[model samples]
Target: MPTEINFDGIVGPSHNFAGLSPGNLAATQNAGTTSWPRHAALEGIAKMRANLALGLTQGILLPHDRPNRRWLASLSTDYASAPPLLRAQAMSASAMWAANAATVSPGTDTADGRCHFTPANLLTMPHRSHEAHETARQLAIAFADPAHFAHHAPIPAPFGDEGAANHMRLARSHGEPGIELFVYGKSGGAFPARQSRVASAAVARAHGLDPARTLFLAQSPDAIAAGAFHNDVVAVANEQVLFVHEHALADRDAAYAEIRQAAPWVEIVEVPADAVSLADAVSSYLFNAQLVTPPDGVMTLIVPVEAAGHPRVAAWLETMLAGNGPIRRVETVDVRQSMANGGGPACLRLRVVADPKTIDPRFLVDAAKLDSIAAVVSEHWPETIVPDQIVGTSPDLALVQTVSSARAALLRVLALEGVLD
Candidate 1:
């Protein structure tokens, strides 16, 4: 049997408001505000616990070290000597959004029958560009069994890869063959289009996916301008159901035709533009919700509180639930800290469909392990982090030490002390 495991990132100790992501509206709007790293990390852990309580498989990804010393050293600069902008980029805790970790092709979809993972280059933004190597290393450790898991280096640049954030897989069952939908943006009026056609095709080829079972589509330019930075912001899929905004794709009718041709059983739930405008969808992150199949086989939509708070979105969800559809219930999760940084429930995890027994046991989690992680966060994570404190010539260098110490405590708690090294 195939099991879907969610590997959620532990919000980093240096979590703060630097506003590095260009297309992320929340990040831009919340720029320079004080951030609560302790609360962020604990909130992340609570979300994982909630998933576990729902009988969903949960796993953890340790937070990447902030003041990314290695990335700084590569440029021959130290924290004290670097410019404030560069310093802020290096100290970013963007890795907390693991949805961009990698584009994964489960064994069921690959020709080799070995699960494939290609860590995203994320070359569009300086803060995220440094993530590929570290993410690759962590994925290797988590999926160590060579026979069942295959780890591949990120596709070279000029082709920006943003990982599973722009990719979605749909199948009748986790163990069955599935269609891999790759979404790329041609252009963003002001911001750079992060995912490219070349990168999407390359990832599909690298995973040895069957051409007949794969679909590559262009993301709507309008959606990108409306703060749909990644495809997940406007669309998401699970099993045979696809929940997407009307403006999610460039050619909605054609995309739907192709999807139906590949999987005739697909249920396309198109949220009408009149019911909830694209702007509202982006603001509420209505499509970023997690579509899951609980043990009872009824599909559930785990959404962020922001979605529930939106009057139109909430009303639309109620109408949808009242009808005969794959989504039977809608459950709300807090994740407010992540939300402030422009991520939602789906942004916090990387989903891998595989048999649990085949994966590295160390990455899996239970109630006791969640408690230990929460304890570490409470003990070492700072209540608030001021961006200015870690920035210029006379910046408070002690902030770096504090972040390092917190990461160390978390590493020990997760038994991944040297994982980053």
Candidate 2:
């Protein structure tokens, strides 16, 4: 039986919200939310400090507990609409979100939960299977399949770019079955066109799959190597979809043709300028923790809700209601306050596998308490990485987790006004 996606957690850093997405910055300066874990600039130096202090393998930014609902609705609607995967979403309390997610079904998973969908990793995410599996293991402990106790959720600790096989190995060693690994032949990041190919090769070598069985590199029309950001590809209810770059130097045509051979039932297309390609967008959503729901559903989209004008939001609202998707059931609200607190709709929420006996779809209800969110969009990113030319990458987790402090303060003020909840 094939494993399919039911839902997925969107991931990505929201620049419109967090002023402090750690990127390539210098170390001589003081570190704050926006300047935490950047790339190679003052990187290793800063990481040394974090490693000693908090086991900082990588500087991941997080939202302050409460999420933006407006953004989530937008995201959910985007997912469930026509063209499918590139437009899916989930629900949040009072905001909305949107992403290039294709589906929620996993093509394969180890007994532990290490999963594999397709080349979305090759195109977008440099390393995502390892990340999500880690999330399941370290944070949620959800992938503890008994048979593969040691290999459950093959999450890489010192995560190196080993490619899909390494990721699959980690997942499978922990208990997943054999996954098809896409092989690429390069290694660099500046030219995203080669990202898919390079990532595919790197992942295969990492997993050390049999070179014979592995479909070695056969350059796509234009060097399409990487998959979408964060390895976010899904197949839902037999429907499949994923985002691809419309014009990234990579061969969009080859990608469509080849990925289909294995992911035979997927919906692949070019990324939209108005939005990141559905594949890349998945990582973007994950970076921010956005969801996929519908229009009428209240959501808290956390990113630059204000960056795109109300009309854009309005346009977004309209675009969300396309087919038999979920957008029709949502309502949108722009909650900038939550963005100010470092998380938009997606950041604060996570998608976990359900434990039938105790599942609660309202995963975020308790986390959204008035005083639960309290950080503000970091007001200090441009100062950190501009020196290096690595334009857009957020700093660290401390910048955007939960905003307990601010929420508490709000409660106090509300209490003083005799309107506390």
Provide the lDDT at 40 for model 1.
91
All candidates: CA RMSD (Å)? 0.9, 16.2
- Candidate 2: where are CA atoms >4 Å away? 1-140, 147-159, 162-239, 272-421
Can you give the lDDT of residue 172 in candidate 2?
19
User: TM-scores, in order shown?
Assistant: 0.98, 0.37
State the C-alpha lDDT per candidate. 0.91, 0.27
Candidate 1: tens digits of C-alpha lDDT, residues 319-376: 9999998899898999888999999999999999988898777789999998988898
Please write out the lDDT profile of model 2 over residues 1-421, one tens digit for every residue: 2221112121122222222212111111222233221121122122223222321111121211122323334445321231211111111111111111111112133222332222222123321221232132222222233322222222133322222221111121111233343433232243232224444544444434445334433322222222221221211111233322343323446645655565454444333446533333322221232223212222222223332344443354345445333223222223333333233333222222223223222222121221221111122112222211111232232322322333334335323212211
Give candidate 2's TM-score. Answer: 0.37
Please give the lDDT score for candidate 1: 0.91
lDDT of candidate model 2 versus the reference: 0.27
Clashing residue pairs in candidate 1 are: none
* Candidate 1 positional error at 344, Å: 0.7
